[model samples]
Target: MKFIDSAGVEFNCPVTFTGTVTTTPSSPATASYMVKRWVSPTITQADLTGGQASQSVNLTGFPGGVVLAASYLQTTATSSSSNGGTTGATLSLGISGSTQAYLATGANVLGAAARLSNAAGTLLGTYRASDVPQVTITATGGSPDLAHLTLSCRAVVYYLEVTAES
Candidate 1:
């Protein structure tokens, strides 16, 4: 089969699975993996108007389960020196709530241009299913950011649904 893109919309590629792929036996299909789409708002000057801006997604899944993986895909490039400001702009992605830093990987930071999944400098550790998921962008180069006009992108969250007995 082949992956299909929606009309005028696309992205949020699935994470590449490698190594030993294990699927344990369980009842009620516990420990099963899943993915969710999180369409983000356009990263515009307003987001960085005050030097920072952000978008987020509240994940819903089994409480005892864990987030398997997460990624960001920039579909439409920003105007220039994008993301938030003309320069010194950075982005971060990870789980929200108490475990905010659970996936604070620099690999997800938006670069000089609109960055894709910056899943580096950190490990995708125990991101609890009870937590929310999202991304935050900041600007350190200008007052009332003007260069970051339009940045279109989406994110994908992979999770495992689990139960205590499973």
Candidate 2:
């Protein structure tokens, strides 16, 4: 039988314990505590204006943690008047001003969809929930005309929170 003193743990450790003997001591190895979560914020069409040459995919609700590989990006743009001769796009994603840390600049953002996976691991530091990671997508190549153009963008960021700093 396993015993728990005071019927509680310091960090809310697991109550049940595993042992090979029928008798056990009051104190046992306490399991480490850690919490992990994910947050994805998307910038909708309503958030953007009709005429624009460049824009940032900055949103809110993300957390401060080590970014994971499962992060994803989805965006689509259409123009009511004209596509603005847009031919190419430059995408940069990272923590704050360091946009090239995670995803390097000119990373083919206009190619349907994009993702931030471990394959291209460039993670540097932890992010804050209040300041959802920023991904600046600057239209480049050809002549990008945002007049009467509606663009919708969305990004899903994954991260892990650990108890001890690694």
Candidate 3:
């Protein structure tokens, strides 16, 4: 069987059947059934500025049967000044209303990409269709005039449908 959305988008569904069938005055056979449904990866991206409050990416209203699978964060563009200070700028990622990722950037220049995942190779938390993820960037510490800094962010998220057994 196939599943289609209002937009006429088709979803991938692989099914298998195993059950018991009996014939009149005959032997009975056992069988089982299973259906595997899946959706393509769904991605979401957002740009955020440095030295500002946390920015959020809302994945609300996404089609059902899709859950957050994985995510990535990178700095697309950035500008920073020493402001005659010692400390440099920083960037971070985290779930909304939770602790920021331990991974952080350093110095005025943009740091390396921050891969967001746990030791188990999973994202920090379970995110449903209508979840919001957040990102934060710390301004260069120094004189306002000299410490001016800005950063653009791009976040990509992958979504997949939950298995029937699960």
Which one wins on lDDT?
Answer: 2
Instruction: Estimate, for each residue in 69-122, the C-alpha lDDT of model 3 and write its tens digit.
Output: 555455554443434442444444445664353223333434433433422223
Candidate 1: deviation at residue 125, Å? 3.8
User: Model 3 has how many clashing residue pairs?
Assistant: 6
Candidate 2 lDDT (Cα, 0 to 1)? 0.49
Model 1 Cα lDDT, one tens digit per residue, 1-166 = 2333336444466645575444445422655544433344444444444333344433343233554545554535543454433454445555554223433434323333454655431425444645454545543454424345344444444445444562
Backbone N/Cα/C clashes per model = 5, 1, 6
The Cα error of candidate 1 at residue 117, in Å, is 2.8
Model 1 clash pairs? 107-118, 107-119, 107-120, 108-118, 108-119
Question: How far is 52's C-alpha from truth in model 3 (Å)?
Answer: 6.7
C-alpha lDDT (0 to 100) for residue 139 of candidate 1 = 38
| Candidate number that wins on TM-score, 2 or 3 | 2
